[model samples]
Target: MSTFEDLAELHIAAEKLLMVPAADEWLLRGSDRRLDEAKFRKVMVDLLSAVNRSVGITGFVELVRQVEATADPVTGKVSPAAGAVVLLALEQRIDDSVLEERISPIMVVLSRAALRSMNAERELIGLEPLAVLQKAVIPNEEILFREMFPELAVSVDGYMVTAVGSHAQAITPVLVNAANPASPMAIGPLQRQLRSQVADLTVKRATMIARTETARVYGETAKETQRTNGITRSRLATAGDPCPICMEEAARGFLSIDELKPIPLHPNCRCDWIPDVENWLPPMPEVVQA
Candidate 1:
């Protein structure tokens, strides 16, 4: 049985193993060359592969075990079996929409950061940033997932294809506004910007994924327990951080099961939802005998 802290550490480790390296590799490639569509596609593919390999069904299963082992703070009871089912359902949701729900946004953010780094490089060199005429088309998710997790891929090649052309379209204006193509550009600032963006986005995306998945699994587990055991209320438990908002919310105490919501009060929120099975039923009103 793992503690909540143990579960957190596992998530952090997975992020470092998968997310950080992928982001760093992308930034490295982006910094090494001028914006080229071919290279960018290659890097994106590599990133997707890395992400897929880093955390698989096995990793998620371990997470489910950890979450189940940890006792609900309010009730001090662990519901491993129920939690397992909920986690599996969450996995299904991830499989159905991971590309659209998770990867695409991450790619867009990475692309934006790359463009910004290029512009910053141009500015440092006294040259205006180049206006982006067209954006790299984001590759098909099925294709990306095929080599790694073929079973998880919905189709081999043909499926609903969505391109990240809009992400490129949106960022071009920002680059055009900041760039001065007429002047000479330096390489140092651009390199620095790429590194910084990579580090920042890596942590941001990883934390978002971890926290979001955790919240989903926990919420589903709580709901399952409610349905199974007739439990009707839960409470929010924090990592005991000094964050004022979390503390204030924690002070508010237990809420009805229907009223309870997922954690992540903000980005990187480490709070957990603890089902209060023991005290779930509300007190009966006394009869008025006049």
Candidate 2:
């Protein structure tokens, strides 16, 4: 049976390869270019269906709302502006998934440790779904360790490593599913089911992209914690939250002023950095008051 460790490892690998560059290729083409509206709608519908299957009904509804809200009225299509908005939303969902992936490993490892230390099935009384969940999560860890520890370590790899290695191969299924051109399901419930699955997967795909970017940013080794010096950049910008580094209020500013940075912040940072040449300038140093 699979242990949480096995499942966690699988998740890590899955996270790494789940989103590919090609996943957003269609979205990118929607800008300025006159894309086939029929094709674009079809793509969105397929994407909705896939997300519904994996996540459920609520996810699909949310995705449809986002797509509708962001779609361009001018062309009856998704424009760069809409694409940008949806992409950020996609990024937020990914952030949640990343946290989920990191914590899941610990859960699996600890659960197995408990089971083995006790050595009795009855010791797991009232564990119910957790017991089953653990089994499903890490089916092969103990077996592999007993059967081949050193070899397994050599052959297999850490979660991040395996994830990076497998990401490209994993993209195909997502692409095929998201790009499916099938007619919408006839039944209402089935249609709902399809949308939920597609929405969930859409979010998952975003998370995968975030993970891959994170791995790329961190490289093979651990990254040192970066210290940022908050500097205000522009006064002619939006007044609410200023960019810490350059105090400007562009539409794509980070949530916290302290979080502001160049595009692709923290491997998975979906915050965009656009150049407002008219407003761009170095932040003035704070003067000490007497």
Candidate 3:
């Protein structure tokens, strides 16, 4: 079995190989070719399609098929035969929530990491630890360093894709700004700036995915630990001089287990709601107001 670090490294490697170089190549040489919003989006669709295909959701998709398959009420088993699948849907029931449980490749890796952290916290408090993901995919939004998004995008074909980290909104400006990007791209400021923006966008999206999983798991785990006579309050800890908003959030001091989540944590925000259990994780630099 692949460890969390292994999967994470694979994701990073895939991005570096598949997304960044191709995007930069296009930006440097192709952005000027009758550039327009629609065209740029098309380019994005192509790039993201390639990336998704490369990373693959093979394992996850297979799992989804098994979990979503209608189980026979009598035997409590499912057959792989096509006839059995048809009969299950027509005869047995299908779970609508099953589709939602399907996790992305990157998410599976990140969520596993979150479980590790959550267990670490539980171990500190002498409580039983969790081992499964019982939630939707979410990124660690509080991370300060990332190697990559605008937001989720749905193309005209009803397909949503992540273009490395570029978004529909950013495409317009990139369409305008990417003209005449420096050749021998490594030497040009605008080329670097454009590439940097994409990297920043990707980082935001990736962080959000990782943070969402980590925060949700941590918050829920914190609540669970509290049931075992653990700490009831949480402190909004920060690295240092956080932006105004985080400064304000920090002022709120201790919050209940229910109120412990500070998610949708602003970009550049390094604050995490630590269980006020003493000796929690160290504070991170607060996010500057966006």
Using TM-score, give the best candidate's number. 3
Question: Candidate 1 or 3, higher TM-score?
Answer: 3
Q: What is the lDDT of residue 275 in candidate 3?
A: 61
lDDT of 1 by residue, 1-290 (tens): 11222222223322321221124444555533333333434444444344334444344334444444353544533455544454444434334343444444333333343344334433432345455502323444223323322321322111112212111122222222223334322545533543454444334443332344333433453355354455566677776463887788778798877776665676566665565645345335469999
Instruction: Give the range of the ten consecutive residues with the poorest summed lDDT in model 1.
Output: 156-165
Q: How well does candidate 2 score on lDDT at residue 57?
A: 39
Model 1 misses residue 205 by how many Å? 5.8
Report the Cα lDDT for candidate 1: 0.40
Model 1 segments more than 4 A misplaced: 1-45, 48-183, 186-196, 204-217, 230-232, 240-245, 262-268, 277-290
Model 3, position 104, has a per-residue lDDT of 35
Off by over 4 Å in 2: 1-56, 59-63, 69-81, 90-98, 106-290
Best first by TM-score, ranked = 3, 1, 2
Q: Top lDDT: which candidate number?
A: 1
RMSD of each: 26.5, 22.0, 20.8
